[model samples]
Target: MISACHQCGEPIPPRSDDIQLCRHCQQSPPAFDRTHAAFAYTFPINQLIPAIKYNRRPEALGWLSLVFAQMLEDRIDSPPELLLPVPLHPWRALKRGFNQAGLIAGELGRHLRLPVHQGLIRKRRATASQAGLDRSTRSANLFGSFRLTGTIPAHVALIDDVMTTGSTAQELARLLKGAGAQRVEVWVLARTPTKG
Candidate 1:
């Protein structure tokens, strides 16, 4: 839980008490419909995640899932029809023991009492990471990379660990929309602020 504004140092009421945004977020709305981040991607979280992913710390997913579920409790309407984790290239999935986002989504589904659907796939060839790319380039990197397989209900919530440029979500949403999905919204664990 955030006790004060990250940028301005103003006091922030607990999410349960009052507030969706600190003064900063109020001034600048996020790109997603309603962004919900359990904690900023800094310090322990940033360090711990890489260690967990690289060192095979599967237990961390449990804690991450619990925090993400609590943060999203108020925003999402009764369990989404489906929960879809952003897909990773097959090679990446192989390199990493497991898809962190998928693990998080699975835990979230369990907590929220929803079905976790793993029907979507990364159809495009693997490309460079999005860490250093501009918004346009980020979109280009993810373009045509995702395709839905099997059955997908009309409404599904996309899940990811961090939402930065939002290009990944945008592209995925575009594909889902094209495939007759009625509506698609992203539910990420973190939404990074725009940096100039």
Candidate 2:
């Protein structure tokens, strides 16, 4: 069963009351209108993300994209006008040899028959890894890191490999909204559970 926060889509424990939104999302709304994660960032799925990201297993991206696409098909009623992959700093992209998010977005675009716009946004600078940072620090680190290039569609989906605290997605969504995107949705392969 997909019992999760109504806004962020983070998995929630089953309960009697029909509480939809998570406490954090209720207190402070995210820039994205909604989020959909294919799987919980746990156990085997967590291992797969690192393998595709750090281990340079570009071949695994196809499988991951298929899984995420199926999840999106099940959750979203309609496809967004455009797919915007969360960008990587140029330097980081060079070091990594590929942007995993971009690859996944391309695959998903092909499957969903939507346009994937790679150059719509660029990472302005490299920042510290958000692996161990708290929510506030993560938000600060990503501040002003994204720059929108040209016109953005009214509806766009921000694609990413995984969402931990959602700080990165939130930052990018804010930028997209500022650039005239009326509605932004976050689509990710997985979502790491957060502490309540």
Candidate 3:
């Protein structure tokens, strides 16, 4: 496979320095150091992710996380000390009956033998749906929306179902790094080209 963005996992052209990074990453680096995506948020994945999120079909995450684990086996020479899932607001979690990111993190933890820490971060307030929002709006909406509930590990990975514009990852990672996390990586099931 060709090299991908070191920050967001989007494919990038080969360069003289051979840095596996996209122009966007070079211009404005994300808070997370690296990203690992199992699939693009397209076609079947677009459909499967909704079933797992809205339709309460967790089995899909099970299978997907397993595949993601298998894929990571080769890429991850050294695993992080902990797995932190992108959290949902209490109201959202209560209404949805579950946090998809938490579920994915649980499955990944079980397979990869990593510790899952859902309590490290908490969504402090509810925000509008990010589904159709622009990047600036999304960032503004999430500002100060999450707070740290516990200590953060120096080396950790953020787990989630999908990465749209990475606004959530940016917000969470920025918070984690500020709170003492040294190496923060993002592991998502899929990454969409457009912000979702």
- Residue 113, model 1: lDDT of 86
For model 1, the stretches where C-alpha displacement exceeds 4 angstroms are 1-33
Query: What is the alpha-carbon lDDT of model 2 when measured against the actual structure?
Result: 0.88
The whole-model lDDT of each prediction reads 0.70, 0.88, 0.88
Error of 3 at 2 (Å): 5.9
Candidate numbers sorted by TM-score from highest down: 2, 3, 1
Query: 1-196 in candidate 3: lDDT tens per residue?
Result: 2456878987555667867877788899999999999888888999999987898777778889999999999898779999999999998998989999999999999999999998788999999999888888999999999999888889999999888888999998999999999999999998876432
State model 3's lDDT.
Answer: 0.88
Find the 10 residues in a row with the least total lDDT in model 2. 1-10
Which parts of model 2 are misplaced by more than 4 Å? 15-19
What TM-score does candidate 2 get on C-alpha atoms? 0.95
TM-score of 1: 0.78
Tens-digit lDDT string for candidate 1 (164-184): 666887787777767776767
- Clash pairs, model 3 backbone: none
Relative to the true structure, candidate 3 has a C-alpha RMSD (angstroms) of 2.0
Candidate numbers sorted by lDDT from highest down: 2, 3, 1
